[model samples]
Target: MDGDDRAGGLTRRRRWPWVVLVLAVVVAVVVAVLFLANDREPEAAPQPADPEVVTLPVPTPTIDPIDVEPGTRFFESLPRTVLEYALTESTADQAAVASGAVEAYRLVLGDGGTTEVVVLASQWRDADAAGAAFDELLAAEAAAAGIPVDQVGTPTGSADDAAAGEQTQDPAAPTEEPTEPAAPTEPTLEQGPVEVDGTQVGRYLLVTRPDGSGTVHWTNGTALLRLDGPATAVRDVYAAFPL
Candidate 1:
């Protein structure tokens, strides 16, 4: 072979090896980039959270008082004075039928015509009838006061039964010694029975109105009575009332 041809062949062999090395390096770089891309994790999209729920309490309903016109019959049974208040006006034969009573009377007593006290008296057929009527009246009063009926009064026993000592004890049942009533755990809306000389004379419910006035309803014998006046004065008037 000629010298020139041999030199050219050597140069070509060296150039071929360099080209193969460059191709190998490029292939390795491409494989590394693909592997890294496959190993990476994708980011997740954000989602909305559930809305919170809230509950509210219901409110008690209010009641309005009923009005009646003055009647003609004389209310002779009503007391002339209750504490410092004096009877100024009276009416009868107005609420008898509605109250399920044989007779009904209403009396207004006040200081100098200011109208501080009002008295309502009704007579039923018997103690049972009066008690039923009293329950109805108390329920109405409780509704007007926005309180539960159970919170109105706690009658130990009927006035007639307690007065007569007629409550019979069950001989077969175990006799438990009288225990003092537990102190009330919660606030009471009204008082319980009215006692005189350790005898339960009646049950009274004292409910205050929105105008700051008060009402007292009680039952004695066959009579159901109600007294309305100042929040502080009604209790005194009710205690002084004879009915």
Candidate 2:
């Protein structure tokens, strides 16, 4: 379900901003054409002028995953935590955010190593819900791994601060970056990864390296989650949920 936001006497869809921008572009092109025609120099009254026509491109908004399929089973079965994070977290990448669903799996063969994969779906009630669900899923995934949930959750703010720093301190800027009113804000919820069973869950791959190991994070409006190590196994599992 698309979440509803209302105030005063006016009611508008949550997705209206992108729509309005596209329309503005269309209006501009139309006005430009009219003005050009009005200023055309007048020719001799008796001479018939050849007709000239111009075509302008109209703006088209990109479609979200939710628009193509709303409330599909792919979205319904998604773990709540994953859903929460996708809707809330601002750091989600565009490809993941655009995807309407998420899928990830690891094959724990009797062998020593693990095979894994993860995918996110892009369909949801709204941004708020998507963010909340994504964070929750990350917590659950981390818990499945040996990592302490606190480590995952505790990093939320610091990660956000780091992200904000990157957004503001663009290298292209000549002087110190000035903060603007429209600058991206930090996440609303406190979050971190979880310990899955006793193992430290890597959203993509759990590593035992000289440095450190962790999962990969991916998210979208309707889907968000982490995958620990390798992608093959998780990718296979994700395929089943597409119906």
Top-TM-score structure, candidate number: 1
lDDT of 2 by residue, 1-243 (tens): 234334422345545877899999999999999999998898758977788898865322132112122344654555322211121111223554444334322211111123223333344555455566665655665555445655643433577788898888868877866676553232211233323466533222222222233334444433444443333333333322222
Q: Provide the overall lDDT of each model, using Cα atoms, as 2-decimal numbers.
A: 0.70, 0.42
The 10-residue segment with the lowest total lDDT in model 2: 82-91
Clash counts for the predictions, in order: 0, 68
Residue ranges of candidate 2 with Cα displaced over 4 Å? 1-118, 153-215, 221-243
* Pairs in clash, predicted candidate 1: none
Among the numbered candidates, top lDDT falls to 1
Relative to the unseen true structure, what is the C-alpha lDDT of residue 18 in candidate 1, on a scale of 0 to 100?
94
Across residues 104-187, which tens digit of lDDT does each residue of candidate 1 receive? 877777666454677888877887887788777777776765567874555446788875654575567786799998764332
Which consecutive 10 residues in model 1 have the weakest lDDT in total? 58-67
